[model samples]
Target: MHRFNAYRIFEKEGQVSARLVELGIDDLDPGEVLIRNSHSSVNYKDALAATGTGRVVRRFPVIGGVDVAGVVVTSGDTRFWEGEAVLVTGYGMGVEHDGGYAEYSRVPADWVVPLPLEMSSADAMAIGTAGFTAALAIMRMEQNGLKPANGPVVVVGASGGVGSVAVDLLAGLGYEVTAISGKDDQHEYMRHLGASQVLSRHTLEMGKKPLEKTIWAGAVDPVGGEMLAWLTRTMKQDGTIASCGLAAGIELHTTVMPFILRGISLLGIDSVQCPMALRRSVWERLASDMRPRHLKEMTRTIHFEQLPETFDALLKGAVKGRVVVEIQA
Candidate 1:
């Protein structure tokens, strides 16, 4: 049996640490299919898990990555065949279960999603969990009556992975996207992602009122905390906000005035446990009309060995866009 390299995380004495180790296939957690992983991408959650900055990993000595894309090397499940391209995200990965920061990943067939529309594994990982969550948010918001003609849509935390994808996706669909970012350096990058307007998080007034002047027709908010509360007060009548992350803080301080008076809706986006049918459909759309136009330009790849040194930038919110880890070739 051949051994492969994996970035494994361990928790001991209430402290977490990770390092690269060699492990044979038998050493990994058992699953129906074994994938020869080609690429994996860094999400904010991945950074948090590896750095022990967040309580994300539930199991000790688990591989550390939330998203992986590659070709099936072998499958005990009849649903998957060798050489088929697939990707897996969320659903206990990098948490209670071993994940994709390895040369190979073994996962339950149920969690596998076939690479949609002839997409390469690199492209799949480029989009990764972040892009999927963004697309899912847009899908949910549209079902709640959001559209290009519904007026402007604002994306909070617009320089991060999900936020960047949201800006590009919303703009590709014709919505006038206003990107909110704290980084002064990323305003031009935001504009390049199709943002009609870029708002400086440090300079913009969030305003103090139960209900502020109605501005956004819709909002893709991942920042939470005060930003989410601000979004609730400023949405147009019957507007929707898709809450995806808590990068700023989890606590939400908002009144029901917007919900009751303006008929605004707050839709929580749960990409981790999203239903399979919906997950597949959203990914199909992502490969089609909803794919980010600047995906290649917005992404950069690093060799697998570079993984350990890359998380600090993501944790510090310094990275501009997506970072794909090339595990093979």
Candidate 2:
């Protein structure tokens, strides 16, 4: 009986289509916690789900958003109660289940994270999966012995969501950050997020050697492929690289010289299906040490009706930073 607005994607005969339509509560997937979705952030995966370009959605008629934050309206689980703010991210949202591109979302209680004490619903999604991924990358680097004093850290695709957040978080932690981006327009924005320097993406392109000059102590890479290959070879001896995203491409073509000779580690990061315990810790840390100083500046708010156009822009890389959809409106 509870009708709401939703962006639903359906696949028929191997073809996918999506549209914003009206649906009722009974149409949603079964779950214990019902969220009145206030905000959901855009991710590259969301674009894939919305447009069906990557076969991301494992099921038909799925909602397409991987992150959501809002107040709980009702709950079947005792661990949560009415009026409590919460967030949901990763774990195949928009890919394998109904997700946050709607005015309401019903998800398993276990998938919910109590919003950090210091973070508001808007701020929670402003960080979204991208910032969470950035936090995870930092955590991975730390576990691999990366320290602020080790030297400068580099973030590739630095104007995009994951890279922007990584740049800000690394710089906030007192590590010098070199941002690699082709969008010259983002230079000042990167600086505002605490980047020590911004390098053109062209600087990392073909240099005709298996190994190049070593400069970075470590790197947070979202633009894999050649950028990852370059980072692998150019990192300082014993350095590590937290590899996430394949915006560039999935294949990594390179020699093993960096790993064998330099002892550099290529650490892969996956926000989806990240352990619940680590998920909670990473989010808590996002409100603390990993919180970017300019998170507000990096977020743009749009309403539910605006999702389609924005999704297109995000896929074309025409949008920068984070985009939070005000689903309820």
**Compared with the true structure, what per-residue lDDT tens digits does model 1 show for residues 1-329?**
59999999998899899899999999989899999999999999998999899988888989999999989999999989999999999998888788989999999999999989657889888888998999999999999999999999999999889999999999999999999999999989999999999999999898889999999999999889999999999999999999999999989998999999999999999999999999999989988889789999889998767776788888888887899999986
What TM-score should be assigned to candidate 1? Answer: 0.98
List TM-scores for all candidates, in order. Answer: 0.98, 0.97
| Candidate 1: clashing pairs of residues | none
Candidate 2 local lDDT, 1-329, one digit each (tens): 56888888888888888888898988889899999988898888888888888888998889889999998989999988999999999986888889998889999999999999989888888889998999999999999999999999999989999988998899889999999898887899998888988888865465757888899898999889888888887989999999989989899988988889999999999999899899999998988877778888988998777777887988888889988887763
Best by lDDT: 1
Query: In every candidate, how many clashes are there?
Result: 0, 0
Location of the lowest summed lDDT over 10 successive residues in candidate 1:
303-312
Native-to-model Cα distance after best TM-score fit, residue 218 in candidate 1, in Å: 0.6
Give the distance in Å from residue 69's predicted Cα in candidate 2 to where it truly belongs. 0.8
